[model samples]
Target: MRLRHKPWADQYMKDNNHILIQEPFEQKGCWKQLFDQQERPLHLEVGTGKGQFIAGMGEQHSEVNFVGIERVKSVIVGALKKVKAKETTNTRLAYVDAEDLRDLFVENEIDHIYLNFSDPWPKNRHEKRRLTYPTFLEQYQHILKDEGEITLKTDNLTFFEYSLVSFSKFGMTLQEVNLDLHETGDETNVPTEYEEKFSQKGQPIYRCRASFSK
Candidate 1:
């Protein structure tokens, strides 16, 4: 997705330093201490596009701590605004690359990982760039607790299939698979901005839950 240049985005991020983590590497393994409930389960959202999903999840599950990491400054500012508006104390936003997961978190630090509408990187040559690639899976397994799981939701069918295969190859067990999420009328399912837009256009939404422990 092409993002419009926001001249003030950098400054805006600095302005919200309290909730927006500017230097995530420094807080590695201490994320729980950043929130009011230090013992709450910590959930990390890989690519929080626009922030609607993470903020909504925070409001829905107060017992869980949410940290949304988005690399794009312009795109992340939008998410920061949503989180700020919601004032969800258990949630925080971070501006960092997914590659730095190891630098920003320790083993068994995360309870769950969320991948909402992540870029498919469709080309065969770009497979390594996909979030479900082995490199990322290894990092996820190292950081997630024994029972930690990954919850993925996307509108792309090919990407969904590819992710399932990737997870299976990595020895991750698929706990749940939903081909048509909306059709199931699962009220507990929170919709991201992209999910709402695509579903409104009559597109099917695919979701899967895969545990790190095989």
Candidate 2:
């Protein structure tokens, strides 16, 4: 769902350039320098909506660094605000498209990726636009380390099933598949804004962890 353009979003992005990286391409392989702990593992959240998950993860795991990628300025501004509120040195936001991920990171630069409630792109003609599409997967494979894993969560069963098939066809091994994530009462699960809302209404959340290493 496209967010309504916020008139102040652009200014907010500029004002918080430190937390919201303006020229992410320039950072490339040196993303770790942005954090205090440069040696810590780096994780990327492909579609960090409203920044709830990333903020929670940063607070929970101070030892790891997190970078959130969101193309929409209006959407990312919310994430920037949350991260800024936390005053965390390990979390950063980038206003860039997912398609340009290769331009922002070098090979084997990323340790893990999180895809939370990405657009289903359910129409047959839009299959190629899905995040789990082969082309996107290839981009992910290039930046991710050999043992890196992609963890995904979605409320849409169709998209989840499609992602499972896509991963399998790409020779990626599924390490874990949870048909109903919330049922397990996993305290480690960081709920995004959408996840919390869906779970509140009795919606089943599907989650899976897949890696390129077979």
Candidate 3:
């Protein structure tokens, strides 16, 4: 995904305390304590495009501490803006590369992981870069607790199919799978920025919830 550099994004993140976690490794296993909630199950969105999904989650489930980390600082800034406007107390954002994820989270630290509209990395040679690849799934394993769950939403059929194969290849058991999510009429579904835009254009949304057992 192409992203424009926001001249003030860095400054905005720096100025807002508790919104963007700086040097997240320092808080590794105890990240939830950073929010006012001392003890709560933690949920994370690996590539929160614009924070719509995560922000809604934070607002809806105040008991769960929600964390969103994005590789692109400029794009993450937009998520931060939405989160800030809502004053959602149980959420935090951080700019971190997905490849270095293990460095910032200790074993069994996360309860659930959410992936929404992540980059597909279409080229076959670049399969390693896809978020649903085995390498990334291994990273998720290190940070998730026992029987941890992962929820994914995407509009790309190829990537969705690839992810399903990757998940099963890595011993993940899929609990729910929906090829056309909008048709399900699930009221609990929270649409991301891209999900909303794409669905409006008559694109089908694919979603699944899978669990990884230790």
Find the candidate with the highest lDDT and give its number: 2
What pairs collide in candidate 3? none
For 10-115, candidate 2 gives per-residue lDDT tens digits of: 8888998889998888999899999888999999999898999999999899999999998877888989989999888889999897566898999999999999
Q: Could you tell me how far off, in angstroms, the CA of residue 19 lies in candidate 2 after the best superposition?
A: 0.6
lDDT of 3 by residue, 1-214 (tens): 5778789887788898578888876888779789787688989899887889988998889889999988788888999989998888998988887556788889998999999998899999999999899989989888999878999999999999999999999999999999999999999898999999999999999999999855
Task: Judge candidate 3 at residue 48 and give its lDDT.
Answer: 84
Sort every candidate by TM-score, greatest first. Answer: 1, 2, 3
True-structure RMSD, every candidate: 1.1, 1.3, 1.4
lDDT of 3 at 83: 92
Worst 10 residues of 2 by lDDT: 1-10
Candidate 1 lDDT over 2-50, as tens digits, reads 7799999889999999889888888998999899899899999999989
Inter-residue clash pairs, candidate 1: none
Instruction: Report clash pairs, candidate 2.
Output: none
Name the runs in model 2 displaced over 4 angstroms.
Answer: none
**lDDT computed for candidate 2:** 0.93
Instruction: Give Cα distance to truth, residue 61, candidate 1, Å.
Output: 0.7
